[model samples]
Target: MTDFENVMIALPAHGHPFTNLKERSIEIIDHHQERLQTIRDASHQLIEGTVTDYMRVLFSERAWGDMAESETYAHLEHLKESGELTRASNNGIFTYTNTD
Candidate 1:
């Protein structure tokens, strides 16, 4: 079998692995689209808060549940890096806003 096929066979049956970094990043972004949009909407309304605050709001609204805080922050940072959002720090607290 080919090297690619061998690698695929080594992965667990229940495991999902991306072929490359770009693919993995795209999958993560797609999975969090709803949460991303919610943040975007809130940001557009001038709402700015830390990742934990956003998580609490999302959880309370039943829009997201039981996701890791770090993962949420990572996604937010990715959006910021992509220029879809803006991040600022005040007193060591990072807040986010929509770029548009």
Candidate 2:
């Protein structure tokens, strides 16, 4: 089987496969603060991108193991609701901005 198929097969059947999800989520966000800030400053509003795009950028340099994209999106939503981040959508495309 392909590596992608192997990874999919190895994933947990329920919930995220990683430990300390919330903490890791926060760390991921914090680690990408500079990039996020740059995007926000350049746009003068939200950082234009999908959750998947943001996820890729944020998680690119880190080893997150079997953590699913959906799990990361949910954590980002939680962060948005908690005022740790700001999110807005236009024409069905979402944008994210850092609060700090």
Candidate 3:
């Protein structure tokens, strides 16, 4: 079997439904899209920003304000893990996009 197929077979399955998780993810992505646009619009200020810049913007926002830097970062990491968005792979900086 191909390496990709072997890896997929090794992964554990989720016994429960993921509908709520998927819905939450969609909401988070929608919110994230707006936050991303804000950061992009203020791009001039972030011309020299690193991955940290992206995290800072996200953490400071109202939607994610209740979350600590580390916490929000964890959420973003989950998105990357789920193949919803790629992290820190754009312009050598932390940028993201939908899988499509």
My TM-score estimates for the predictions, one after another, are 0.57, 0.43, 0.35
* Best-matching candidate per lDDT: 1
Relative to the true structure, how large is the alpha-carbon lDDT of every model? 0.68, 0.56, 0.52
Query: Candidate 3 has what TM-score?
Result: 0.35
Misplaced by over 4 Å in model 1 are 1-29, 60-67
For candidate 2, give the lDDT. 0.56
**lDDT per residue (tens digit) for residues 1-100 in model 2:** 1223224223346656654445555666775565544344543333555566655644654744346455556656766787867788878766666776
Better of 1 and 2 by TM-score: 1
How many pairs of residues collide in each model? 0, 0, 0
Task: Write model 3 residue lDDT over 1-100, tens digit each, in one string.
Answer: 1223223222226454333544445676888777645545444455534445556665655544434555545655665687755555565546544443
Clashing pairs in 3: none
C-alpha lDDT of residue 30 in model 3? 86
The prediction achieving the highest TM-score against the true structure is 1
Ranking by TM-score: 1, 2, 3
